[model samples]
Target chain A: MNLLSIVLYPLISSLLIRMWGGKNPKLAGWLGCVSIVLSFVVTVKVGLHFFINSSLEPISHNLLTWAILPSHAILFSLKMDVLSFVMSLLITGVGLLIHIYSLGYMKKKEYGRYFSYLNLFIALMLLLVLSDQLLMMFIGWEGVGFCSFLLIGFHFESHKNMNAAKKAFVVNRIGDLGIFLAMMIILAVLVQEKQLWSLAFEDIRTHLDLFLTKSIFGMSLATVLCLLLFIGVCGKSAQLPLYIWLPDAMAGPTPVSALIHAASMVTAGIYLMCRLSFLFDVSHFASEVVMWVGIITALFGSTVAIFQRDIKKVLAFSTVSQLGYMTLACGVGAYAVAMFHVVVHGAFKALLFLCAGAVIKASQGNQDVYQMGGLYKDLPWTHAMFWVGALSLSGFFPFAGFFSKDLILSHVHEHHLFVFVLAMIGVLLTSFYIFRLLYLVFYSGKKRDLPGYITPWVMKAPMIVLAFLAIALGFLWTPSFLGSIDLFPQWMSSLYMIPFSTHSLWFEIGLSLLALLFSAVGLIAARKLFVHGPIADQWIKEKFPKLYQLLLHQYYIEEFYYKTFVHDGPPSNRKLSQDTAFTNSLFHFISVIKGMFDRYVIDGLVHWFAWIPQFLGSIYARIQDGQIQTYIRWITMASLIVLFYWFLWVSGMIA
Target chain B: MNQLFCLESYLVISSFLFVIGLIIVLTKNNAIQIIIGIELIFNAAALNFVAFSYFRPHVTEGMQLSGQIFAIFVIVIAAADACAALAIILSLFRVFKTTRIQNINRLRG
Candidate 1:
């Protein structure tokens, strides 16, 4: 398969669907599915070829020369080594399943538009992962962000959803600025060093020594570059400060949440870090910053997830937290471990979201978990799949997340004890929140009567496949003690040459046991508190109203942001009257000045220019009176005066 | 030279005709009288052109009749103009029941 076709298939189908599939939604949905399936098949073919030839060189094909400069040319190229192969497989594979799920999930009227956006999103994400150059990757990066905004505001009828989509777009743009600056700085440094200007990952790696030795603003250029890149990472992956968009991004359709937010697009940051692992490997300070930021975000997200009432919001925050773990792994220079966690988390998080979608559908779009209970019997398949997802997410033994998360925790343990402790707390919170959600939604008995909505087989099939992955994907990278090959890490090790920090079998087992213990503790605690229903929540809410409000309001971070940046002025309840009075007067003075300037300076100038034409037109109006004889008399008199003056001048030859 | 055929005599006659035409156009109330005054002014200009061509001191052999040709072109244009002006006056008479210039001032600004 031509690698470019992997990106093209979905893009062409998106345009085709938009052009032809407007009236027949079924055909549109099938078209979208078939294109993604073809892309997936191509990815699998590439993967199989790589598997058969383990020592095969990273496959690179330049589709065309995108730009030619005096020094070098920028090629629109694709590369499929182990990293791109893994990510391509994940994007196309999960993307295909989500497209199928969307068939049953989306309304008929929206089928064409929704599938077009989904396919465009898949195409962009494949482009993001497969592109060999950073410039091409950035294009894919922005394209996916745009697609996310479109899909999030798919229901444009609601102002709230539109606001959420705008928020996501604007926030991602803030991170995108960081990436833009980083690219400029890279190009500038290359030019300054008299090196060929190339942004391909391989080229950057080959010239990594140039960046490491240089300094910008009294800091290592590599550190600055990596830190700037991390800002982009923070935005796309929904880490600290920039993570506000992801939770609100739940306004999108559930399949969008499953595919873009949870499975594929959100992990692009991790993929980028892994792709450029060579650059990051040099900057210890930047790596520390990455690690700490990840830790805080992990804790923040899991804690916020615990308090969220909306099922999708909870999954959204859990995705944020899991993304934090992957970032943290990348920070520790364990790019392989991060990639492992990325693939596993993509599978289970997508499964979890799909299950949540089924529940929300069954409840007729009631996302509030408080309103749902005892759904196991009604939605047996969804319930079972949710359990698989929740267990995998919470790092239960032998599940996908257990292997990946434990790998991350062990790597963090080797790096720093404090980080390891914080990560353990994050693990406990992860288990607590996910189980709290699971129990609240499914195990609290019947909270109220729900409309009996059957889960369609179309939705059921994807969930079934995902649940199997969530259960068995752990075997792909089992610890040595399990006597299984660590296939995922070995596959990734070729791309990320960082040596794995090895430990004894007993030490590894101890760490896994400790993580399992935390998981169990969180589960038992959730069962104890939430098994009965809202009584425990009511008691807690009454006992600690302030704390409850804090958690419920997401630590008031969104509110703080709104007040500080979005609000025009201080609220009316001011503590300092004198200060408030002065500021108010100052604002009034500025406004008055602005009003006067607008009235006199800007509008007055325009009016003054307009008056010229009006004044001349009024004077000229008298001559256009309709009497033809009067006009003839004026012309004859004027011509007589000119003739007399000319005769006198010509007689004397006057100058 | 005969006084009636001299260039000065022809110039004086045409100028006098032009002045009279101007007076008629300025004082006329009837639309037909104004049309007649315009035709007079055109004939005065054509008469001057023919006088200049006939009396020129350095008239070339091929260009000796150019002034007469211009006079012929002016006479043809004046005839077409008279026809169009008379048609307009006839339409005006239908609309207002009179051809007086002052009464047909509907196009005044």
Candidate 2:
């Protein structure tokens, strides 16, 4: 409920990692889950009050003031509303499920550390959503980003996973730079207009217009700040060029993938977009850019997903595409639609990942679709549950995805038909390819071998629960829960200001049928081609060579980075040699220049300056010397210089 | 806000202390000298805060709060940092029986 408990949940989790008490993995997992469940309960209670009544009774006071400047106080601020509360639910509730699933998923090796890292991640995510000030949120933001790096590289003994985690951290760091820049820019604008600096979201929003009117080094600083902040979003949410790290992030534990990619970290970008939806509304060009980026990411992600061999990798790319949909909602000025997409996508994406985790276990870690065929007979329950998830993902009618995805497509249509057409194609590609994935892995009709480990209760329980949410969330929009929130008397009672009901029952039913049609058509096409043999696969390659290869290589975004950045960065694998050689040569050349100056130029100048001092010194040395002859010679020179000076003065040569 | 800036002006002593710490950090060859430099910087910050409190009488918490918090941050960081430095010193002692930075090139080729 407060900052202590908010941070304590994860801190306690980290302690459990070492509290292995002789290394019982089950005990460690239970301890981690217990702590997470408690945090979830507390946050849920706080969230219930927030949603029912849109008031958090913010506790306000400066935790500590600047030593020399009291006005520059660092206040401990905490409050709750629909948005943070919902995020709290996702962070804690979905977090609890992932924690439980990890018990089974991470049964191998040092699971104590894995659970500990996962718990820390959950805690930091809570802090990010719950904190009141931008500075506090930044701490939580960076904290979670760090935890993501930790969890993603939990198998750091392996080089590829470790590098993937590093890449993720570095990419997010670049985005975070944008966040820092935006904060600095915001501070500058606020100070210039009001003669004060504030990081409180409410206070900054109050000075929004004044900030827009100000200039920064001849640039419209508001646009700069917004774009910079979007860069941060782009990194986390995996939009366009910045999304290369996510599919590789699948190298971590599947639960980690579900938690980070599906449920929490990736959505942070969308949350940020929605949080600053008010600022974005003021910039038409920026919003349009957000829209276009979303479309490209959606199409790009879905196309790549179609060709991915690894089960989790396909779902990984799917998340990037889905997040693009949420971002698309933000771009089209339908922030609520974006938020809605986040909820639906979180539920179904997490379900799909967990289900994929189960199937991978069932198939004895053979996640490649080419290795999997007709697993439906062995794991019927998993198959059915996986169907619910895959259908929901494909936007089948009467499921969660249909309501959210169609709302986005309809909103885009209202704005512009071209955007709508892009979203429609995105919808079609998503439906076709997700079904393609489902058919390839599960429904190909050829008998496949399955492992016995999938029968474990630990594995199937969370899948069942997620499957229900995936099925039932669509019904929440049917007018019952809308009236329940007394304090927040709006439909869907979310933090964002948008319509709860955007379309009629007719549109909802019609879209559901159409999605079913698309899914069925895709399923049939895949079954007709791939259910029997390798012919369909060969045909696909032969028919669509360039497109298939492009999709297979993720559009060569990695290749671009490889050519321009990494390979060139340490050229020809000659780093140490080049570094030592360059440093020695440059320093040597400088010394040679210094040597010439010391011998010729500097020595000549010093000798000239020293002449006067020497003449005076020789006369002074005549007063006291090591030898009498040397002293007499110095006296003779001094007398000669004095006579010359007197002659010049008397003869008027001084003029 | 007015008192805040006045306090900043009086806080030059803390800035001077920090500068001295920086010089010691740079010029000292001994690890302990660098440690001492860090402490000097911390003291400078503490003194700066106390000065601000004196300047801004109406702002009661100005100096005391920051001085105490900064002292804690410094103390905590210093403890951890000192442990790391001491470990390096111990390893160096084992290798060379001396704490000279010039001779601690076993880490280099």
Candidate 3:
């Protein structure tokens, strides 16, 4: 029941609030929070049960089955396993916090609409995590994308927000196409060749040999599926080429930035890859692409993060970078580690964003970090919460980010050295930029006499809770030297086919120490550069003008995309015009026929029918002169005519 | 009634009355005259119905008197209709200020 409600209750709340809560914004907001809280409680209950009963098998709750063929069936179901349990707990728990935060974050205009979208997002996110079948998961997946589109464009009054939402949706659709195509190919293969059709994860995993044997244009079908699925991952997780939308998604409200962009929805791609770990494990080429994509995106996101001016954009890029780390863990076959990072990162990233919200709120809607400085004393609680969140994000010791990141790093190091080196670069840049954002926003420069905007308790409560989580949640799985509890990874071992290989305590400790040192270095460097104002900023901008400009402008990838696709491909390609002309003329011909049919055939028939009624009405209307004498004369004439006809018939003069 | 007066006499009188009423209705310019002409035609039809009921053999099954009942219903309906027609004429006079039928052509389509 609890498991069912985890997906059901929020959907119910969304509908109810949409129906009845529009008149009362406070009631709507509270209703949104209450629904998520209920789901959160259910998730916690289910998660605890799952943890306590370690030997328990994955429980599949089949809701309905649509039988398409005698041999095939598609089941709409929800599965409760160690993996979904962890993800659900994160989604609901952090989702509730974000909902509470949104109460304070949203403005007074159409806030019920905002709460509706928020609740809808939670429901979809839960559905995505708890879904049993791949098809069902895709439904949840597309649903989350749709809700994100709605929430990101919540302030649809602004063109910028609407465009950002459009970009995010369009990019995700491209990713979804990959999932769709992969599903199609898999289904086609299962139905046509293997003669066994099901999309349940168990069925797919069991039929690996059949999938491996099948070849698509000379490449193994499994490899193609994995690669295509990775393409989907790239889009959702904000990896290379598709990472453009996440930064601009900051045009939405801040709590939305925290929940969908940073914490839960963006990690869906990583979750998908982890869910399909067995398939990915079999495809070496696909794994390599995933690794490289993760590394490049991590580097790209962080480098861009370093140059970002807007407070939310900085966090947005940092989120893109952090998602890259989780994706990297998946690529390196550390599925459990990737999931662990997903959970820990969900806590801290949400904390960071909520604190940023407080800052944005206190600063009177100013989002530029440079315009905001010395806010530490003005917003003491927010400052402290931001500190915890930032430290955790930077992989500072004892915070949640440190443990999971350390685990990922150790695994990466054991598997590949060059990949590990690139990952290290990404880590350093992540730390430097986040601390730089912190230093610029909170600690550095002269303090402005900001208006006395009190941070609401609704906002502060979530930050406090997330801050606590950021500080202590890492203890769930500490390294061996730190007493080696390792509860989270151990708990997740059952979900993945290949368990994480345990490393020596010395190696783990060494990696943890190194991560701590790098974090400290990044923090100290950020302090030196930003704390004293414009010296390093000016120096770097002048010294590496081209590099600075490239990073600042996100390497002109958006412009390149516009130039290539939006502006009719390249000028050098003359064939493009010919192709377009052919298609255009074809469409024009069809449209001409359609117009003719509409104007002459269809409309002519209607007009002809209308003319009949009009003609008859005119003749009848002439007799209805409304004169009593004329009406009486006509009645008498009609009576006489009838009498004459009757007389003739009586005399047998007419037949 | 048939012994006292031949059926032809009643038929002739009613036909003459109907013709006179028709001529009056066709020629009348006043709305009230047109209504009176219509009532004269209605009375002629009522008289014919009574004459037919008396002359015919089995129209009224002993005490049923269906034709007489029908004539009484028609008379009652004509009285109500006359009252309604007079009310309409009064309203028409209020709007147009004259009861001349030829002039009251406001409803001409």
TM-score of each: 0.83, 0.71, 0.75
lDDT of 3 by residue, A336-449 (tens): 888889999999999999999999988888998878899988999998998899899989888889998888898899889999988888788888999898889888887888
Question: Please, what are the lDDT tens digits per residue for candidate 2 over residues A340-438?
Answer: 778777788888888888888778777788788787787788788888998898887667886677667767766777977777777777876777777
lDDT of 1: 0.88
Candidate lDDT values, in order: 0.88, 0.74, 0.85
- DockQ ranking, high to low: 1, 3, 2
Which ten residues in a row are the worst by lDDT in model 1 chain A? A569-578
User: What ranking of all candidate models by TM-score puts the best one first?
Assistant: 1, 3, 2
Pick by lDDT: 1 or 3, better one? 1
Q: Write the per-residue lDDT of candidate 1 for residues A89-168, one digit (tens) a residue.
A: 89998888888898889999899899989999999999999999889999999999999999999998998899899989
Clash pairs for candidate 1: none
The DockQ-based CAPRI class assigned to model 3 is medium
Best by lDDT: 1
**How do these models rank on lDDT, best leading?**
1, 3, 2
Superposed on the true chain A, the predicted chain A of model 3 yields a TM-score of 0.86
